[model samples]
Target: MDKLGNDELATILKWVQDPHDRKSLSLVCKRWCKIEGFNKVSLRIFEPNSLHKFLPRFPNLLKFESSETISDTQMIFLAKTCPKIQRLNLKFDTFDASNDFGDHGLFALSKGCSNLRSVILRKRRGIRDGGVASLAKFLKNLVNLDLGFCKMITDEALETIGKMGSLRSLNLQGCCLISDLGLSFLANGILGKSLVYLVLAECDRISDVGVMELMNLRCLEELNVAECGPKVTDIGGKAIAAMESLKRLNLSWLINVSDDTVFALAEISKNLVSLDLTGCEMITGDGIRAFASHKCLCEIVLTSVNKFNANDLEELVFGCKSLEFVRVDARLRSWIPVTEQGNIFRPNCWISWRL
Candidate 1:
């Protein structure tokens, strides 16, 4: 081991996949520890308060994750120490009472870490429009951004994001402050050309007008507008059907959408693979059966949609050859015969009876 060079040691370290084994290697000697720190690319800081003490050891880190309530000072230190970081995850499951981290830290990080490609700030209350704007302005290579549950951001933040041509995925789930105008900004700019995945679930402020604007995103493949209030009716649903590139869609709890939207989706969306229509009380047996002729639909969720009977399910199971999974109300299990249920499962499709 004494004869081996730093390059050879790093090559051997590459094969050490186990964290415990890597920790043991780092303890062998000061030289080994220094080499290990230099080679470390990803790190998850359990105690962000002590970041300044240990972070300096890993200057070439590409990814950093912390679930703790990291303060502004710690974040600034990290940004300066690890300028090459490409992915950062600062998701907090619970809100912090201290509110020590905010836009100042975010601005500093964005200025220092210009190479950031993916950032997840889910459930962060401190991040407002100013921070987001700074991120959009500095991180030009950023592709995926998750601002879910960041309730303070409004249309102003989206206006900055709409200009980010390289951004491909955005999550605004639970951002109630954003309205139809924000959606229009995202739909009209260069960002529309690249964005393929978007989540707008629980954003109740958005209605048919906002949803209609999404049709301009020609490359969008997956969308989630579940639980977006009763304002989204057949008009919004029909607009979604226009996106031929859509592969997965969640229209759950959209109670106002009727058979027309279903028929449109069945006939228009050729690549649709997964669809969730749970709690869609307005859709009936005819609406459910419309998907029988669809070629690419494989997974569907109809739990709580009581209008469809067992006969409609039977036709759907028999007609759609690509179907592999179906979720329905538990009450429907007794309506279908045991032999038919067995037959349904035998043909590579499984049913999930939800209570």
Candidate 2:
């Protein structure tokens, strides 16, 4: 048999049972060294030298989860090696807020990756406004981006991201450093044009004023604001309800939202598919009734709402034919027709009522 070609080696390396066997093949010759692909993937970083050793091992990896110290050279190696990488997760745990991923690595990866899609940078203290600005310069076909807990980013970075009009999903959770000023930049720049799924959980400083800007998203579908501003009360709920295309909504821990939110939302978003009112305590039976009126409402999660009784929930189930998932507390009345998809309801959590 002719010596295994690089393509064949790449295929065999994926299925090889032992890591030593894979490395043994990789060290076969210079031809194997230049295979233009890699297989080693894990979340290990030994201060400064582990990256130097493992950076060039896998050039065409699909998924990368990195946590420890990230250097500029390692960033370049990964970007150039894994040109078509689809998912990348980069998180930094330090509070130093140093710009770790510089513009050079970001720009290179953005330009090199053709099939790139989902990118998440959670708690990344190394990525700042300048690094992101360069990254967005090349990522024009991006779909999902999560900048959760990236505290050093500013409005200018968001402005760069706005250039990608094809973006559908975005998560800005835990970025307490960015104010509505940055959000204002995002809303006015590109998010309003193409965004569908948005998550702004735990971004406390943002008030309704920032949300007011997002109302412009014509194709917006899902929104999650589990912990944010004082404005996320009925007023903001009403603002979100104004969007006709909204399908899924999460207002789990909003303190100020009352029955008014339910009343307002009942009329505006007729196409709602799923809803999460987990901790909105002020809403009683009336709020649930409002949600019941939605014809397309499917899954509902009301985990900690104190006011809603069983009658209201039953009415909601009766109103929507599409409802499949329901989560409530232990105090409410039992459901009408006990049905658990594929599983038996062994334990009864509510009182039985027939009126």
Say which candidate scores most in TM-score.
1
lDDT by candidate, in order shown: 0.92, 0.71
62-105 per-residue lDDT for model 1 (tens digits): 99998889888888999999999999998887866265578889
Off by over 4 Å in 2: 3-48, 92-115, 333-355
Q: Candidate 1's C-alpha lDDT? A: 0.92
Question: Would you list the clashing residue pairs of candidate 1?
Answer: none
True-structure RMSD for candidate 2: 5.3
In the predicted model 2, the residue pairs found to clash are 38-58, 38-59, 59-81
